[model samples]
Target: MKILDRYILTSFLKTFATVFVILFFIFILQGIWLFIAELAGKDLDAWLVVKFLLFYSPNIVPLVLPLSILLASIMTFGNFAENYEFAAMKSSGISLKRAMRSLTVFIFALSIVAFFFANNVIPRAHYKFINLRKNIVQRKPAMAIVQGQFNAIGNFNIKVDKKSGENGEKLEGVTIHKRLPGATNTTVIRSKTGLLRSSENDNLLQLELFDGYYYEEITTKKPAERKKVPFAKSSFSKQVMNIDLTMLNNNDMDKEQIAHTNTMLNLKELVYTIDSLESNYSKERQSITDNITNRINLTLSKPKIINPILDKKIVDTTEVANTLAERDSVPDKLLALFDTNEDKNRLLEIASNSLNSSKFVISSGQNQVREKIKSINSHWHSLYEKFVIGFACILMFFIGAPLGAIIRKGGLGLPIVFAILIFIIFHFINTFGKKLAQENGIPPFLGAWMSSFVLSPLAILLTYRATNDIGLINMDNVLLPLQKLAQKLFKAKSKEAK
Candidate 1:
């Protein structure tokens, strides 16, 4: 490579490394916080936590790369500009465009890497991250148990005085507060010594305690009428109970209850699901429309029939008087027209029931149609997550490069703060888009990409103006308007006081 190329490449790489380290540390800290909160009490190896973070690094790296590149480009250019090296290069017969060519090439290569990482590597890592956590949660019961706190393991909220052994296979003193779901009272069990073991056949964590007492507390709330008795305790030499975690979670049956969302699905799988859901929704809507039309046509085609039951005679005078709202209103001529009012009432009731049944069927069909449409909508909305996240790299580069050039600071202080602010805004907008898309059926692609799409041109315009020395709005300009407004308000306030 030429001296110029080497110099530019060196600057870009150095800035990239610096920005990456800072971002990666931030991601690592977040990972640690999440794992501690979620996986701390679980019986998993410390190495597994390390592995989880490391495996997830690629996922985070792609997200950070675009911004990092943008920042790196800006810093590299800003440093050259500040030191007058850009002028020196220009004096030495190197163009401004030429100086950036090396960096641009570097960025292009990086963008490709970012795309692959985000599209393929990151999605796979998400699955690994999810599955690793699932395995840890399912296989390791000891890690799930907290020392002092009440840990609801399976159906038991257990606390241990001391835990020993490498795998937490032994407990010194164990107190279990068990409450099966749908049960009225909680069962308290104390064991002098206990052992936790997993079932070989399934993911069931079992507790075998020795020399323990089982006490049940039943609350009777009729204090005025009933006497209160304390809990009854029963001592046992040894007790064994096995609880199946899998049995408790019927949602994880691997059935098609809900769509596995976008981040959870690969590209092919996501596309297939979208297509299938769309087709199903279309079919359901058509079926519902056809059913409603057929039902209406059937109703219209039905011949009117004269009912013998409605024309039945009323034999008892007392029954006739009770059935009629007013004897004078019914008129003496029509009073003996019906033989039996019960028959007429029964026929009217049958007609009402049939009408209600038809209405119910139509309503149910409409509900199903709405649900199917929602399923299709949800599938599309899910796809937006991947779409937005995948393009964040390109967007970050746009903003980062310009901001870095504008700030003219290479180190972590101002540049980092600005980068974080930009990221925060971007993330907030992205999240908002997701919420709107999910809830309101806002155009999925438009909603998800709104931030990046809107911001890109602004970034480009800023970068172009910065590079070409064309003036655009800056922080000083933004503050100027606010400052003027504040001054006017202050003057008005002072004049009024005077």
Candidate 2:
């Protein structure tokens, strides 16, 4: 390799490494802050927290890598352009494309590695990360109970108006609702103050209440005999309640079941899962159609007399006229169907029942179709995400490299600003497209590649401008119109003042 190629590659790789570490660390810290409530005051071991962060790091990599590449590329090329090294190389008959040859090759190789990492390593990391988080949450059930929220603890639903103290043991204005087994009544307890403590073995929680009222509603067996349901109420100075923590234990969850989620699958597994889901959806749709068709056919095939009074061509008009005359005007033909009140009631009941049954069938079919579509959309989105991440690395490099060269700025000042702005736009487009696809507004493939389609043209334009030694943007062209408009506005304001 030439000295210039080695120099550029080495500089780029170093910048990439530094930028990646900084960005990853920043994101990890942000994640910690977001989950501080869940992790802090849990009495968790230091190693466990570190392990959780380590497992979570892979999820952040896909986000960090692209941004790191953008920043690194910008800084690397921006340095060259600012130092006039690019001019020197250009004078020596080396084109911008030629100068980018080594870095381009390196980026391609990195992209391939990124693809494998995303497909193989990241999926396992996601599985482990999710399960570990669940286990941590289980281990610290008290942490799961947020202040000012209703929390379900076994058969009891507990809420607190305020929770304080170092371990969040002190509670004020507490309400507990306990469901009775095999009974319709609930036991409600309200406390002015309470203390929460865990057992030595951590298998149970003890709640001690102060100045509370206990109320229970009792239902009598003979509702017909009682004028009102009876209830029992009692005031207490202090009371202790025991809550079982077995359900919240980590052992309750099966690792295999949690690991089977779409986020935990590689490309091959995702494809297989998608295929299975689509197959099941197709079968369900076919079954639903067949059932609906059969039901409609059965309803159609039932022999029905088009003329209900076929046996009597000339109905007894005198009786019908008398019946209709009692109401108001006499309609002999319509009054013939209501020969008796019982007959009219039965006909109305049958019609109502048939209408309800038809509504139920239609509603059930629609719900099934919607659920199937959502499941299929999710699978397809996951499948496309695997390829998109790798491609994003290469795409971002093209954008950053040309942008840096055109702007002719280095360091964390201008380059960082430009990188962040462009990255934000890219991320927004990608997220918006995914949401649209998830809602079935667009095709999954198109949604997944939407960001690429939008940014590819910008990358090409930037590269072209950079190769021709054009400025990043024409400021004069933008400012001239705005200046003229402002002057006109100022003149109009002055005229109004005069």
Candidate that scores best on lDDT: 2
Listed in order, each prediction's TM-score against the native is 0.62, 0.78
Task: For model 2, give the 10-residue run with minimal summed lDDT.
Answer: 299-308
Q: What C-alpha lDDT does candidate 2 achieve relative to the native structure?
A: 0.85
- Put down candidate 1 lDDT per residue, 1-498, tens digits, no spaces: 899899878977887898778877888788777777566655446787776786667666745665676566667666777787876886898766576677667666666665556567776677667766565554555567756667766777889888788777788788998887898778989989998886444566778899989899767777753355556779998999877776443333122223255666666677898888878878877777777778656543433322324645535556555555454466565425556988667777877897897899888997787666555555665566555554676566656665555556666566667776777777677778766665546777766777887677877786687667554456787899999999999999999999
Q: Which stretches of candidate 2 lie over 4 Å from their true place?
A: 152-157, 172-194, 200-202, 208-240, 246-259, 290-336, 339-357, 473-498
Q: Would you list the C-alpha lDDT of every candidate in the order shown?
A: 0.69, 0.85
The candidate maximizing TM-score is 2
RMSD of each: 11.3, 7.8
C-alpha RMSD between model 2 and the true structure? 7.8
Clashes of 1: 14
